[model samples]
Target: MAQSSDIEWTDATWNPVTGCTKIGRGCDNCYAERFAERWRGIAGHPYEQGFDLTLWPSRLMQPEAWKKPRMIFVNSMSDLFHKEVERAFIDQVFDVMERVDWHVYQVLTKRSSLMRAYLHKRYGSSAVPSHIWLGVSVEDEQHKGRIDHLKQVNSDARFISFEPLLSPLHAIDLRGIAWAIVGGESGPRARPMQEAWVHQIRDACERDSVAFFFKQWGGARPKSGGRLLDGEEWNGFPWQIVPKSIIEQLSL
Candidate 1:
């Protein structure tokens, strides 16, 4: 079963794999790492590696058991495309996704190069499952190259996550993108996110007519900060990709 997530971009989280190590500045204060340490004593805890690279093959079939259609965050506690995760394990993960066509899986990773290489060698362009929405994490200008790499992937739905946003990104080219999710970092040592940064992305999305979702205000504690920009919440998605038939079916 998929666990309902507080993350504004998705409905639920399904960690077929868990545990990851810091790979970039955006990972300086990982919420998943902190959560793992706090719940170390719990049974069946997926984050047993305590921020160390580890894979949990036992969780691969969890989505198959889910009856309803859901937007599942794949590997929320870990990066499925991490270097430590073997190619065989990735195949198993893809196998589960292939079988469970009812659920929409959102897989985001910082390892865009590895992802590109894997997709090219293993699945190629035609093999990217339509139900899977692939995305890359671009926290700063240095990581902006990830956008280009993500564009090369053969996935049907491609997106970008600018969460824990560290700097103002200007002239973002949303050429072949489907959606963009922006949010500030939130934690005890969370960094401050500027209002101008949020507006810049929002404005770009408006101009390009790309789907934009504002996730949070991220402060010392995200809950205390809340997810309000100007006065309302921005939870929009690209309606074009989301078929009208599915919309009608969901409405019923």
Candidate 2:
């Protein structure tokens, strides 16, 4: 995984586990799958097995090695809650995240139900650590239930990503969410995102007081169309959720 990421949101990516199966329409043109497949069958390559669920137990301690605090995106190339992953393994990943403490980890997944169940089991009635911000991906209205699942979790740092935004998510409720990222699909077969669809989300974020971030206006490439929305770039972040210690270190 890269120590630095080009992603506008997080600072770096740490893939303690890699590879995942497609769970929905959002996975149709997965950039992670495309990147991993390119290294398929190449001996000694991290993704030699392609986008097949593989656990990297050795990488569990990667975050601890980094002394500096940063915003780390966990499992960017995979979904940590994939059904194929064992409960014990998931525990190890969480264990590391909890112990590391210094870094803020963004664990995003499309497997909303599984994540909700696991978090309930792991933390019981207590809230998850604020440093470990949990989130879900909602590509359209059909997947709006994911947001509901996220809200059910016992945390105030919940967020949602509407990237590769396929269809209009009309009048979605963003009440419990702290942050929302919206963007169009980017790839060879990228789908066009209507301005009205984005306006709906941005306006709702304002209404619900959720931090809104407009990632990109996707095309053949991520930045091809630019990130301008109403002639301005929206890069809102949930700084309120980040711990004070991390904020102090970041400023240093």
Candidate 3:
């Protein structure tokens, strides 16, 4: 499925792959899994098989059809690095991203190590495509290693998503990261996020010159708590890596 997204960070979503297993606390209340499961058993439905590992070879060309440029959140419904997804299939996904240079594809994943290994093998000391942004989902201090894994990649378009911020991320380094997005978990079983935790990351970003974006504060629903941090909204973005041509088009 490919369409405009309600996600605050990106303009659209492209799910050439679907379904994933939980790897950590962050996956406990996955909105994507919940949404996909609801349509299970429905005849001819896109999610008829529910949140099972499935690939859409047909949807591989969706982005090429979108003439206008966009910020697409790749695989919002699944992880591109899931063990079930074959390496050859991943090549196809990257191939599409490589071909479609107009759009900015944000590929965020909890499997940071897997993604790092894949990129190392694919690009091998060369930089990844500038428009295809690589990022890792970090929930707390325990997953700090994911950031390190991201830093090892050969790309300038690197970012980190701290959504469902589970605990205080004290003293974590942000030097090599280009962008950071922080938010609390939402939904019925949502976990509470502390003010200090948000500050910890935001301050680190400021000190290290990384872009910081505050997505939400978490509650029964995604927007149950408005996105605010200390009486202000943080909407930092990294525009330094955008190519000159795309920047001109974006201004239009």
Candidate 4:
């Protein structure tokens, strides 16, 4: 069963895969890694291996069990497009999404290279399923290239997640993007997010008329930090209608 996620951007989570190795600074203090270690004692625990890039074939069909429509975050605990994930397994994950067309799956990946390569090999120029929204995580200026990589994929909708925001990003070319989600880091040993960073992104989204969602003000305790910006929370979605054209190509 999919659990309702605390993540404000999406409604539910489906972890067809779990556990992943650190590939960037965003992985330095992964909540998934911490959670896995906390549950290490459980017998045959999926994350008992603790962020070792494990896959759960049993979880592949979870979306099919859900009868109602939902906005699902695919692999909340891991990256579905991780290099270690086999192509056949990726196909199986997609199989479920294609079969359970009632739900909208939002797949976010830090490894945009793998995602782009896989999509090209599998779908080519054909349209991506309208129910599936693809996204890439960009925590800092260095990771911005992931956005360019995401543009190459053929998903019906494409977006970016700039959570745990570390540094300021300038001249953000939201040219081909559908949505933009921004947030600060949270938890003990947490990083501080400057107000300027949040506003910069907000302004960019406004200029491009892209949908912007502000996730949280992550500090040592996100609950205490809250997600308010300039006095209020920004929770917005990109698509107003189904089967809309990808936004980056539009001239603002």
Better of 3 and 4 by lDDT: 3
List ranges where model 4 is wrong by over 4 Å.
Answer: 44-46, 241-252
Top TM-score hit: 2
Worst 10 residues of 3 by lDDT: 243-252
lDDT per residue as tens, model 2, 1-252: 578998999989999789898878999999999999999999998889998889998899999988999999999999999999999999999999999999999999999999999999999999999999999999988999999999989999999999989899866899989999999999898889999999999999999999999999999999999999999999999989999888877521
Ranked by lDDT, top first: 2, 3, 4, 1
Clashes of 1: 0
* Candidate 2 segments whose C-alpha is farther than 4 A from its true place: none
Best by lDDT: 2
TM-score versus the correct structure, for each prediction: 0.92, 0.98, 0.97, 0.92
Between prediction 1 and prediction 4, the one with superior lDDT is 4
lDDT by residue (tens digit), candidate 3, 108-209? 999999999999999998999999999999998888899999999998999999988998987799998999999999988999999999999999999999
In angstroms, the error of model 2 at 201 is: 0.4
Better of 1 and 3 by TM-score: 3
The alpha-carbon lDDT assigned to residue 78 of candidate 4 equals 92
Report the Cα lDDT for candidate 3. Answer: 0.91
A best-first ranking of the candidates according to their TM-score comes to 2, 3, 4, 1
